[model samples]
Target: MGISKPSRRGFQICCGVTVILLIILATVFTILAFTVFKPKEPEITVYPQGLENITFGFEGFLNATANATIAMIVGINNRNYGSFKFKNTTGFINYRGDVVAEVPIQQSFVPARGKVNISTYANFMVDRLISNTTFWADVLAGSVNFTSVTTVRGKATVFKILKLHASVPSICDISIFIKSQSIETSCKTKLKL
Candidate 1:
C-alpha cells in the first residue's frame, strides 16, 4: 500500500507545528534561566554573642589552660529563586592554623528568597592555644583570637528540572575578651556552584 498525498501533507504540517512549539519553549526557558532563575551567593552572618560557659584552671598557679563552649547563632539568607537543601556538616575552629574544635551543623533547608537561623555549639579546648608561645602574652592582654570555618553543601532545584550543586563557606575571625565576657567577630562568606 502507498501513502496518499493529503495524508502526507497533514503529517508534514503537524511536524512543523511541533518543531516550532518546541523551539519557542526552549527560548523561553533559556531566557528565564539567564534572568529570573539565576543563582546567587547566599549571605551568612554570625552574631556577636559567640562564646559561653567559659572556665579556666591553673596547675600550681603556673600552668594555665581554659575550656569553653562556643555558642553562636548563624543566619543564612538565600537570594536564589529555588530552595537550598543542605546536608549535615562540621565546622572547624582553628588557632594558629591548628584545629581545636568541631561544630556540628544539622541538615536543613532554606526556601527561595528566604532566611534561616541556626544555633550551633561546640566545646573548645585551649591545649593548642597554651602550647603556642604567645598564649601567655595574649592571656596577659586579656583577649584570645581564633578563626572558624563552616561550609554548607547542598543542591538547588529550579522548576523541578534543573538541579545544581552548591557550596557556601563562611569564615570568621573571633576575639574573646576575658574580663568583659564579650566577643568580637568579623565574617566573610562565599558561594560556589
Candidate 2:
C-alpha cells in the first residue's frame, strides 16, 4: 500500500523546525553568557604622594643650583608626575626655584611612589630684589619678581623659601602660597611660607 508513506512529510517538517529552534536557542544563550558571565578586567588608581612642605639650607641649594643664588629655603606640596614640560606637577614654592611661573609636569617616571630630593635649577627665580612685605601677596598681585623661574622636583629634602637677605633685603625677598586637595579631601591646605 506504498507503506502509507510513513507520514514522511509531517515528520520531516517537525524535525527540521526542532533543529532550527535548538540552534537559535543555543546562539541566544551563548551571547547572554558571554556578556553576563565573563570576568571584568581590573583597574588601578594611584594615589599621589603629598609633599606638603619643605625646608632646606642655602648651602644645599647652592650646590643644587650650580650657580650663586640667594640664601633662602622653600617647601611645597605638589604632584610632580615626571620630568615633563613643566605642566603636570601641581606644587609651588616661595623661592624662585627652577620654574619661575606656575607650570605643569607633563611626563611620567618610575617609583610611582615615594619622595625625591634631586636638586635642579628648574625652580629658581634667579637673583632678585628682597622685600619685607609678604612675597605671596606680591605674587598674587601679579608682580614679576623674576625674569624666569623653575619649579624643582627633589627627593627627601624640600626647600622652603621664607625670607630673603635681611642685610640688603634687595637681593631676593619672597614668600609662597599653595593649596591642593587630595582624592578624598574636602578642605585643601592653604600654606604661606
Candidate 3:
C-alpha cells in the first residue's frame, strides 16, 4: 500500500511544531542559566570564644611550656542557587608563622541560600615557646596574636545538572588577652570556582 498525500502533510506539520517548541524551551533555559542561576561566593565568619584549661609556666630550669584549648565558631553563608557539599579538611593555627595547633573539620553540606555554623575546639600546645625570643615580650604585653588558615573543598550542584568545583579559603587573625581571658577575632575569605 502507498501512503496518502494528506497523511504525509499532517505528519510534516506535527514534526515542525515539535522542533519549534524545543527551540523555544532551549532558549529560555539558556537565558535563565546566565542570569538567574549564576553562582556567587559564599560568606564566612569566624568567632573565637576563649581559651580553656590555659596553663603556662616553666617546665624545668629555664624551659617554658604552654597548653590550652581554643574554642571557636565558624559560620558559612551560602548565597548561591546550588547546595555546597564539602569534604573533611584540616585547619592550622600559627603563632609568628609557626604552626602550633591543628583544627579538624568534618565533612558537611550547606543548603542553597542558607547558613550553617560549626563549633570547633583545637588544642593549643607548645613545648618550647620560650625558644622564640619574642614570646616573652608578647606575654609581658598581656596579649598574644595568632593566625588561623583553613580551606574547604567542595562541589556545588545546580538543578542536579550543573556541577561546579569550588575552593573556599579562610584566614582569621585572633588575639587572646591573658589578664581578662578574652578573645578577639577578624576573618577574611576567598572563593575559587
Candidate 4:
C-alpha cells in the first residue's frame, strides 16, 4: 500500500528524536557510573621525618703493649634493610677540622640487616708517650660527618665507639659495638689510603 508523504515525514522525525534521546541517556549513565565507582588518587611521601635523628658513634683508647703504643678502632653498623652508601667515606676521619688518617670500612656488601667494622692503630716507641695516645683519642672521638644514603629497599647506618685507657707500662684494649639494618656477606678491603 502507498503511504502518504506527511506520514513518512512524521515517522522520520520520531526516529530521529528517539536516537537523540538514546545518545543523551547513554552519556548521562557513563558520567554517573564514573563518579560513583572511580578510585581515589594515591598519596606518596618521598622524605620522612626522623631522618635527622640518625647519628654515628666514635671511641678510642691508649694501649701499653710491648711496643708501648696507641690503638683505636671505629666502626659503622648497618641497621636498616637496605645498604648504605657513605660519600667521601675516606675523609670522615678528621679532628677539629684537622685531617689525620683515614681507613676504608672493609665491607663487601652489608645485607638487609648487618654490621661492618673498621679500625686504625698508632704505635709509639716510648712507654710514657702520653701526648701521642691522647692526641689520637681526641681526634678519634670528635664528630665525624658523612653522607649516609639509604637503599631503596630500606636500610640504615648505625655506629658505636669504644675507648680504653691504660698506663704506658701496661697493655690496653679497645672495643666498639655496632648495630644496623643491613649486613655484609663477606669482608672487603680498599687497596689505597
**lDDT scores for all predictions?**
0.84, 0.32, 0.84, 0.33
Number of the top candidate by TM-score? 1
Off by over 4 Å in 4: 1-71, 84-89, 119-193
Q: After superposition, how far is residue 21 of candidate 2 from its true place, in Å?
A: 2.7
* Model 3 C-alpha lDDT per residue in residues 94-154, reported as the tens digit of each score: 8898888888888889998899998887767765445667877998899989898999999
Compute each candidate's TM-score over C-alphas. 0.73, 0.22, 0.71, 0.24
CA displacement after TM-score superposition, residue 193 of candidate 1 (Å): 5.4
* lDDT string, candidate 4, 123-192, tens digits: 3223322234464463366422212111112112223222112110111121221232221212122111
lDDT of 2 by residue, 42-150 (tens): 1111222333333333655354222222222122223322111112343332333333323233333222223333222223333322333445575566453332222
lDDT (Cα, tens digit) per residue for candidate 1, span 1-193: 8889999999999999999999999999999988887677788776645567888888986878788886767788989888889999998988878888778889999988999999888768866667878778987899988898998899987666778898888998988898898788787878788
How do all the candidates rank in terms of lDDT, highest first? 3, 1, 4, 2
lDDT of 3 at 174: 82
What are the runs in model 3 whose C-alpha is more than 4 Å off?
A: 1-36, 54-66, 128-130
**Clash pairs, model 1 backbone:** none
